[model samples]
Target: MTTTLKISPIIGNSQARRAAAASFFGSMLEFYEFFIYATAASLVFGHIMFPEESDVGALLSLATFGVAYIARPLGALIFGHIGDTIGRRATLIISLIMMGTATVLIGFLPTYHQIGIAAPIVLVVLRILQGISAAGESAGSASLTIEQAPEGRRGLFGSSVTSGVAVGFVLASLVFLPIMALPEEDLLAWGWRIPFWLSSIILIVAYFIRRRIEEPEVFAESRRTGHTSKMPIVAVVRDWWRDLLRVTGACLFLAVQALMTVFALGYVPATTTITSSDMLWVWIIANAVSAVLMPVAGMLSDRYGRKPIFITGCISLAVSVFVFFNAVGTGSLLLVGLAGVLTMGVCYSFANGVYPAFFPEMFNVRVRYSGYAISLQLGLIVTGFTPTAAQSLVGVGVGPAWFLPATLGAALALVAAATAWTAKETAHLPLHELGTDRNLRLGKRRIS
Candidate 1:
């Protein structure tokens, strides 16, 4: 007697679409919590949490903001291990809950005047929880989307994760726009907490959606074969170190995001004539535009290849940072908004769109989360401090008129661009074959 083994059909395109939508909405909520804190740190926290000396207060507030990134590596390690060993669905659901809890706690916490240094200390601890929760978010979502995506459209589906980030920023700014318009006393006292508290609704919605998602097929296969890494950290360090370095180098593009969305808002208000509301409206518009453009760019990468699109974005972002800061110096809202849109919406979208597919594709399935999470978080630590570093470098007219910060941001973009160019082109490769160094034998000619 002969026995036949049947393979299940690949998940349908409609199911992939549903999964992508779920991943996108969940990511939007997660990042809304993350970016809102960054916005509040740049705008309100200095006054309410560290009201002593102006510069020092700003630095301390930003430091508390940076504390989250420090926790990101730990989050990455813990969550990445779970993602590789257990499943993406469980890890993402837990991350959403942790982030929501931390954010709501932040909204309820007492200010420095009410509770002294304990307020800032508690804020820092909550921020750390937010960071850890965020560490697994993009990687988990991207991994899930890529595994489920229809053939030849992984780039487009995966890009939704990054697009969700911009959408989240837009939502965050829009949510806070009215709140920030309140009287200064009211805003610092109460209005500022509203956005953080609203995160509970997002958490509930995300949890419901994410719980419906099944584990990705790739991860399930790894588990069945017992191919899952016993120690994801050890596997990442031993097998995928090169990809880790490349991804970390590439993640520096995040500094452009941090600087534009966080530091620039603070810098413009302090140095120029722009109000916080005006600056936030600029963010709202830029991120809204990015939400539209990121998918288009990701689609383009499918045809023209990821390297060119990724390189162009990095170089353009670097150049645009200087142009944007100079536009802010002009103190014209029109010019400032244009600069924000160009940098965040157009230029940054290239990197943002491609990285969701690009970074994870550089690692084998067994260690994909570990490699992507660790490298991405390490690079993010640098970006998290960009605002504080930019502030120190901009002291009292001794520096180069915003040139120093802009230059540093551009330099990081350049590093990302170079790293992208050096990476293997995986556009035409099948998902199973990705992340390996192999030669394609075409018509008797071998191509890498």
Candidate 2:
């Protein structure tokens, strides 16, 4: 369908700031739950939830981590509709609660020894719930923040969402550092639970912030004028399928993130002398730098254009995979740390910072939430399996096969860069004209 959008007066900066803060904190809560589960899977879940040997348990744990990705697209569809029809603020609140609830219950769950096969099954179910919560978290937050942002500064405001992601990784790492130091029995039995339990505190804080948020004036106007699509998913697929595919391909840049953060945590320590503790420090340093620089990347994208920053990130990440793995092979903590900072904190932030603004800007307000969430989550399904897939690629042991996964990540990054190169630059476009008209002539219906 052909869709046209009308511009609305910009809301007050105070409200926009509130929306950004809310989105930032809410994203923080969501990803904090996410990384903690990842950390637990890598460090604890397999032993606790499965009857298999350590290797099998670890694989199962990683598989549970990927299981959530499978449910994310379903979450995107359900929450996307709620976000588009009911309102962004409410959808964000509901999503945060779902994530928090799942994380906390996981903290309290019974082990396989205590409950037989039920433990892993329950864990997988909870992970799926987490996947669903995450489906809405970033997309809703990005859409809310960008829509509220001043015309020239959506990139800057949108950066807050990804900044939260960086901070979440930092928090997850820091929380685990002390826990990781505990005696092995205690570490497995109780220490890992602390981080998940901490979500209760974050949930309360994020809930209050989100409660204060108001809908963006643009979206409010869309509702008043009845400009909303009756079936946003149907509309987005019918009119914007190409954009959806482009977004999915561009999102493969996340393979860089998956290999760098999640897979490396397992791979580097096992094959080399580097300890998991050392890797956690690397992650902390990288993400701390990323949390700071992401906003800078966003501000730069505002001036330079989204495609340049995004494509640059993809290229940098592709190159850095070789450098990072080389550093790992050398067993130099400093080299590895520096490479991690460059690959994740600096390079990946460029794309991560801009995408919140870039993706949603491709769709009119009527289908923006559905389009952004569905496309983003669809790509993430593959990303979620990267660590597991990487492990499988190594066969019996890591050996020189570590490079295999790194090479795979680099290739995906290049593919994302190429896909991004083909997209129209949305940074300087007026909000109402953000999407393309390349497919307009093929539409059978018109949306006004």
Candidate 3:
């Protein structure tokens, strides 16, 4: 007797929720590892990893942050192909493993004092590996959660992943707050390493959870129907390049997040009177509020469409960033803190919250992973260098105060907003209808 294989139903509400939970926790752990490096780079690296001259140390430390971005695109291309051709679940597992290992090794590295010139060189190498891992995390998580989501709720689930990132940032800040309070000697010698070591634990748990999570039904069906792309990257480069450019441009809004955490935090202590703790508190508070509101933004996008919410986010970010810097220039702790909350928490939330839905929806399933991963990571290269560039620019004074970080943030924000405004609204399109002109929804079934 011949037997037919039974296909699974299109992801039901239960599986969609499970995927969102997986995406959330996976993102939380991955970003927890990432932000520790970012936090330490801003607060501790200059002292331990580089030469003792404070200015030189600060510049080199921030430059190391940029180094990771340089590696992200390579990761994106590799994993994007794997996700599109093999499966999102496998791609996600490997990426997490790489990130976790690099982060833990960073915890054990010898300081420059112990290792001479080779310390920073090792540090740079590890940072590049972390970048490669990160390149896949956001895109894979977003695509998985998106494919699993039922119609009309992709934005809501997408926001869960962003909220995971926000929570990770908050957790990273809380872990470091006490460490930063340690005496300079103790902090350099031991306390800072503690946060990185925590990654080993989070990584193991995340890997297991992600490995067990099944590939989304939609992608599985696509493969069964022979609709999977043989060379997704080639297809992306050839057919979807315009959407790729738009996605990359839209992803530039991420620069604001980096500016908020890195440049703005560094700038306050390096030039202004605000304490690092005070700034950390501002970050903690603002990011907390932003996390709470991210789902609201996503649901709104689901209802009103992605472009409107995203464009509004970009414009609000533009105005808020200008105000944030201007407030910093005034030297009042309250004004500075409030400005941070307004820009990072409120204005930028719109930009960050909407992309998980807006970005992935732009491509067909075969190229969706490649399109989202490559475009977003390529845009983030600019964000990675933002701290170094902002610092360098301020050294020469630019047009009152707004001409520095604000000008850069505003210009990027405006460009991203224009990109979103011109793009087609995808929220109303059915999952099967999305990213298709001639391409039809490959595999679909009636859920019984």
> What would the TM-scores of all predictions be?
0.93, 0.95, 0.94
Per-residue alpha-carbon lDDT of model 3 for 3-70, expressed as tens digits? 32222333377788878887887788777876788888988899899878555898899999999999
Candidate 3: 10-residue stretch with minimal lDDT: 439-448
How well is each residue in 84-180 modelled by candidate 2, as lDDT tens digits? 9879989999999998899999999988989999999999999999999999998899999998888889999999999998898888889889999
Model 1 vs truth, CA RMSD: 4.3
Model 2: colliding residue pairs: none
Candidate 1 per-residue lDDT over residues 1-448, each given as its tens digit: 1222222334456667767887798789877986889888887898899756655787788888888889999999999999888888898888888888999999999998999989888998899998998898877888888877766788898889988888888889889899988998999999999999998887887788887888777778878988777787886776667778888999998888888777887888888888888988888888888888888888887878888889999999999998898898788989999998999989999889988888888877777887788999999999889888887767535544688888889999999999888888866678878754521222322111
Per-model C-alpha lDDT, please?
0.83, 0.86, 0.86
The candidate, 2 or 3, that scores higher on TM-score is: 2
What RMSD does each model have against the real structure? Answer: 4.3, 3.9, 4.4
Pairs of residues clashing in candidate 1: none
After superposition, the stretches of candidate 1 with alpha carbons farther than 4 Å from their true spots are 1-10, 51-55, 395-400, 438-448
